[model samples]
Target: MQKLKDRVAIITGGAQGIGAAYARAMAAEGARVAIADILDGTSLAKEIEAAGGRAMAVQVNVADETSVLAMAEAVNEHFGRIDILVNNAAVYASLQLKPFSEIDVAEWDKVMAVNVRGPFVCAKAVVPFMRSNGYGRIVNISSGTPFKGTPNLLHYVTSKGAILALSRALAREVGGDGICVNTLAPGLVLSEGVIQNTDMREKLTGPVLASRAIKRDQTPEDLIEPLLFLASDACAFMTGETLVVDGGSVMH
Candidate 1:
C-alpha cells in the first residue's frame, strides 16, 4: 500500500516555492491534498489533479484565526478528515535589511503575524481535529538561520526559532495521542525569497564546499525526502525532532 494512501493533508503557502513543492510531493505520495495559501491554491490543485491525485484549493490567511478556521473547515468538509498539516506559510519581507535600530515596530509585527502567528494559528485550529483522530502528522518548516547567526534577518529568523520550540513542546504533549509533530529546517534551498539577495545566494552556496562533508547546491528537490519522511507513516516513531535538509551546510 502507498505510505499515505487515502490520507488528507493541508499545506499552507501551497501556492508557491517550497510549500508548493511539498504539496506536489504529498499528492504524489497518495494523499488527498488541500493546497491552502493566502490566495488561490487552484494552480497547485490543478497540477495535482492532472497527476490523478485527489486535491482541493482553499484560500487562507494562516495568521488570522477566522481564516485559519475556515481553512480547517474546508479541509474537513471536503475530505472528511485532516490527517496532516504542513505549516509552511511565511513572509520574507524585502524591508528586513534595515538595521535593527531603524526597524519599524509595525513592520516587525507584520512579519511576526505571518511568520510566527500564522503557523501557530493554523496548528491550533488543527489540534482538536488531530487529537480527536488520534493520528496526525504535522510538519513545521523552519530555517537554518536560527543557529547560523545570520545578520539582517531578525524578523524571519526569530520566528523560525519559535517554530522549533513550538514543534518540540507540541510533539511531547501529543505523542501519546498518536499525533506526531516535527520541524524540517531547510538550508539554502535557492528559494524565491532568497533570490532577492545576490550576496546571500553566494553566501548560501559557498559555505558547503568550504565547510561540509559533501558540497552541493541545495534546491527544493533536496527537501522532498525529508518532508516525505515526516508526512508518511515511515516516521511514526519520530516526534519533537527536527530534520535539517541542507546540503551538508550547517552540520551539527
Candidate 2:
C-alpha cells in the first residue's frame, strides 16, 4: 500500500536541488505534492505528473506571511487538505564564505529572513489547516553546520540552529493537535547549486568528506528514506527531534 496515498504535501524550495529531490521522493510515495518555491517549479510539477504522480507548482516567498498564507490556501484548495509540509527553502549554496566581521548587514538580514523566519511564517500559515484535520507533519530542513560549529558562514549556521530550537518549541505547542514537527539536518550535500558553485565544492567538499564516518560525498538520495519516515505516519510517536543524516558526521 502507498504510505502517503491521497495525502497532500507542500514542499517549499521545491524548484531545484535538494528540495526538488524531496518533491520527487514524496510524490513517488503517493503524495499530492505542491512544488512551492520562490523560483518557478512548473517544469518539475509537470514532470511529476508525467510520471503518474500528482503535483502543482506555486511561487511563494516563505518569509512573507501573506505569501505563505496564500500558498497554503492554494495548496489546500487544490488538493482539498494539507497533511504535510517540508520547510526546505533557504538561502544557501550561493553564499560566499567569509569572516563574520566582513559579512554585510543586509546580507545577514536577508539570510535570516529566508532561512530563519521562513519556516516560522510557513508553519503559522499551514498549522490552521492541519489543526482542522487533526493531522499534520512538518519537517524543517536544517543543517549539521551548527553542530559542527562550521565557520565562515555565520548567518547560515545561526539561522539553521534557530530551526532546531524552533522545531522543538513548535512540536511542544502542536503535539496536542496531532502535528509532528521535527528537524532534518544534513551535512554538506553536493546539491545542484553546490555542484555548480566552484567555490563551495573546492573549499567545502574535501573537509566534509574527511569528517564523515562513511567518507563519501553525501547525495540527495541519502536523505530520501529519512525524509519519508519523518513526513509519514511512521513518525507518529516522534516529535521535536532532529534526525541527522550526514553519513555519521557530527554524531551526538
Candidate 3:
C-alpha cells in the first residue's frame, strides 16, 4: 500500500467524483498528490491532509498549453518530482442526438479542445520531468460509450475513442523510459456535474443497465479500487491496455 511512498502525482480534474477518489486513494498509498483542475483544487488537498496524507492544489486548464505547462512546473517546484499523472478532466455538450448536418461546429470544437488537447498538453508537460526521473505512470480516463456507439453523444463519444488510442500510442513511445501509460474507461459514473440535471442522467444511463448483464447501477465509488490499482505499484507491468471497468455492460 505504501509502494508510492513520497511519490508525487498529478491528477487533472481531480477536484470531484472519480478524480477525487483517485486523489485520495493515491495519497492513502503514500503518494503526495497535486489535484490539478480549472476548479480550485483547495478542498481536495485539504481532504488529503485531513486523512493524514500530503497533497497540493494546482489550478490547471488542460486545454491550454500554458496552463498545463505551468501546472507541471508548480507541481515539480512543490514536490521535487512527479512520479504519476492521471488525466481525468472532461466535459460534455448540451446538444442532443441530431443529424450531423444540424450539429454546430463550435460545439464540436469545444469538446475536442478539452477532451483531446487537454490530455495531450498535460502529458507533454509532465513526460520530460518523468523522463529525467526515469519512472512515470499515466492513466487517461475515457468512456465506454464510444466503443458501442452512442447515438446522442457524438462529440463526447468520439473524444473518448481518441483518448483510448492515444494512451496506447503514448505507452509504446515511453515504455522504454519506465513510463507505463494506459486508459481507464469508466461507465456512467455519477458525478456532481452529471447527476445535477435530470435530463443528463436519463440520457447517460438509459442504455447502461438495460443492455448489460448486471442489473446493478454504477456510482462514482465503483471505480476507486481500480484507480488505486493502476496508480499504485500494481500497474508496473501493465501498459497500452484499456481497462474497461463498466461492470460488464460494454464488452469490447
TM-score of 3: 0.94
lDDT of each model, Cα atoms only? 0.84, 0.95, 0.86
TM-score of each: 0.93, 0.99, 0.94
Instruction: Note the residue pairs that clash in candidate 3.
Output: none
Scanning candidate 2 in windows of ten residues, the lowest lDDT window is 1-10
lDDT of 1 by residue, 65-164 (tens): 9989998988999999999999998876254454577767887898889988888888889988888888999999988778787666687788889899
Candidate 3 clashes: the total is 0
> What global local distance difference test value does model 2 have?
0.95
Per-residue CA lDDT of candidate 3, range 72-176, in tens?
A: 999999999998989998886244556566668898898899999999999999999999989999989998887788776788888999998899899999999
List residue ranges in candidate 3 displaced over 4 A.
93-99
Per-residue CA lDDT of model 2 for 191-239, tens digit only, reads 9999988988899898899888998999999999999999999999999
Quote the lDDT for 131 in model 2: 99
Q: How many backbone clashes does candidate 2 have?
A: 0
Off by over 4 Å in 2: none
Ranked by lDDT, the better of candidates 2 and 3 is 2
Ranking by lDDT: 2, 3, 1
